[model samples]
Target: MRSSRSWRLVVEAFPLLILCIGCGPASTASPTAKPATTASTAAAVASVEPDVPVAQPEPIAEPVDSPSAVIEPVAPQPVFRPDDPREPQDDAQLAELGIRVYESRRLKLYTDIDSDAARTLPGYVDQLYDALEAYFGPLPPDRNGTDFQMTGYLLKDERLFREAGLIPLDLPPINHGRHRANEFWMREQLYDYYRRHLLFHEVTHCFMTFVPDTQTPVWYLEGMAEHFGTHRIQADGRLSFGVMPTSPDEAAGWGRVTLIREAFADGHPRTLADVFALQPADFLMNDAYGWSWSACHFLATHPRYRERFEQLGRDGRGPRFIRRLTELFEPDGRDLATEWALYVVNLQYGYDCGRAAIDFQRGSTLTAETPARTVMIEPTRGWQSTQVLLEQGQEYTITATGEITLADEPKPWVSGPRGISIRYAEGHPLGQLLACLRAEEATAAETMLRILPIGEGRTFAAPITGTLYLRINDSWSELADNRGEFSVTITRAD
Candidate 1:
């Protein structure tokens, strides 16, 4: 989520020339006033002025050559510093207002929820700090070299926080979460997993503020935050960030995977460029978050782009960050788009990034000297190239011989070329062979691989001239348990 107010540093020397948008007047109303509903409160908060003093016009000086030179007194310049320390709230007064304070190494959390999760949020935030440090490098200490720390409010009841004077009147109202500088605020979430998820997401924003000069694109800012926020706590209480959740049970209330799948099914799938072009306003909807996360996740995890993607973290804080990013992947731009399309279309819980990484290879046209070509198809991987280009309107014959283990759970289930019917995926029997023709220069929008089930043997006419790519019909999430390979041959039928 984007911050409600954009943080800016006002130069005292040029106060009259600088104009700060979205700056409001400080509130004089009593905090004890009856609290408004969430929506109404957000509207009120958005209009309230921040505590910063308003800029005043400078006085003009009389000409030095005049007989009686006079200079008017200059108005005091309004200075704005985002890092200025907030007024300390008395713990005793906070306790009286039913606000519980929890502190750890990096986080000082205040919440009204009496649940154990709320009590443990500070520690969880500390773990999230470590994770961020690991990913983005350690944040520099303050000018005085003091260790960095953050303050957050997890609001179970907004009224309690408001009454305690913890919720700033100038804070922009948010639907779920918001962050500024080293502080953040979040409303109570229904699920513990999602609660932590949001906490981590807001903390990511806080961390990014420490990085200087970053005009990072909205897609990346939100996407990387969503990437890190999508995490799993291990049995040992260790927090793991950027995890591919194996099931909905592990990531309850997180619908990123579901959102992507639904979009693809609805024929509204976003391409890599589409995701990159997302504006801050687009993020008000949930679908923007899903697409953003997918793009970041794919680039960050894919073997082909991981190194370059990581480099982006270090150098992605400038105005030219997006242009640099585009240039960095310019060489593989086509492949990037094609692969991204495949990734979203096959996205699911427990997606196997390594196994599903496609290796695009150009194919040669068949000739009289070589009428047929054979290739080995692995069930453990996705869409292996057959290296045989097909011409439009030409008929081809395909045959396969294979026996593979689809699973080993209850009992090892073995299947031949014509996959077992007991289990199915993509409306076809699991372990069955599937084929699709992809044009040499197909784009994400044009790269939807239509499934052609060619179990043991089949003869079919090519709908379009393109390279043949094959894979075993199975769940994109369940490829790990697959074993063995199929020896397949493709021949140009005369």
Candidate 2:
């Protein structure tokens, strides 16, 4: 059994999304193969045509002198004060400050100070709900209408926001927003971008109450809220999702993504297993919010992994769920760390999982009698795989040479075009990311053309005798020249 607790994402001034408490690899190339050449054989692809610039949500700075913006490493102090008396309800006094309550089919907005930004509160809430419903479906049945209808107090400025005493005075100022029970609070001035982001994030906290006895992991809970918090409304009134920017240079969370990726590069990356194993207390102790959100984004948008993630939602806590996780996500419960590292490093904003999906094919068969066999081939377009027959207990080495011309413009997944990889026949978490990368299961190519400095040269002993798949992939492909050109030589040792 797990304990219940609340979750939140706190930055200097950003509104933290808090949740109530309750609970809770690998190699390079093959052996016997020649050492991989790390030298650059090809120049990087020219820049691609720029895409229509998507506006990042404007950042709001909190007023100084307020200590609420500072967060310590200790356990999160309860910012939610439901037992505190409600704000004074004097119609005349409130009218003086332009306070008003707007009602909609699914929301009740309370604005402390009425203004153009305040008026649009309902519309934004509607957009958030529309996007959330489209992705997760209608709110869980157990949630009452009041649960969704938040009592939002839009303070006029940081001074007023701090004075309200909605949150602990010692905590950092939550510039974006804050939520307690069904009540939401934020400072509405300058613009609504930060305010909207806060509202969406806190509202998601409101929806969490509906989940049945299951004590959902804080990573998933906050990740899902961050997934929706960055929602963008289109001109047609449709809600677009998973729009977190690609680089920290692009937006706030985007920078966090880069930090996580860099941390991985530094050999300290947090794996999916680490995040999944977190209890309520552990989540607040570390700065995993950005990584958690990225994981959720990967699961939600990646068509290959989306359904599986949905299935995971139905699972409850305890050993049974752990068994399910091991059965579906981590077959051996070991390679998960290595496989997840490969997946997150290659992730990019608007990543198209369909393009880089794994495709196994019976490539030109190689006969391993004595002399080594070699062949020159190009990776198949997309992820439709090419394969080769291997025998159990036999050791093999694979070497790749040459590079493909990637597009000269910004593309999804990783930048430019991707290179190639080799893997054992297992499950595809998302089309491109492998479920398992056991030495016996699968391995990457020694070399491939790509931006990131992933390892080269794949060497491993065949765990089973059968047809293993070699996949041609990149972050994604768009232009005609997105394919990589390479030569692979396969050798068998006695």
Which one is best on TM-score?
1
Predicted candidate 2 versus true structure: per-residue lDDT over 156-262, tens digit per residue: 65454344343445333343445555555555533334356556766775555333323455677767776776666678876565575533322322234444555
Residue 350, model 2, lDDT: 39
Off by over 4 Å in 2: 1-92, 98-103, 111-114, 134-148, 156-177, 187-194, 244-254, 279-286, 314-339, 359-365, 368-385, 389-438, 441-494
Clash statistics: count for each candidate: 3, 48
TM-score of every model versus the real structure: 0.82, 0.58
Indicate the residue-level lDDT of 192 in model 1.
75
- The TM-score that candidate 2 achieves is 0.58
Clashes of 2: 48
CA-lDDT, candidates in order? 0.73, 0.45
Worst lDDT window (10 residues) for model 2? 1-10
lDDT for model 1 comes to 0.73
* Model 1: per-residue Cα lDDT at residue 71: 55
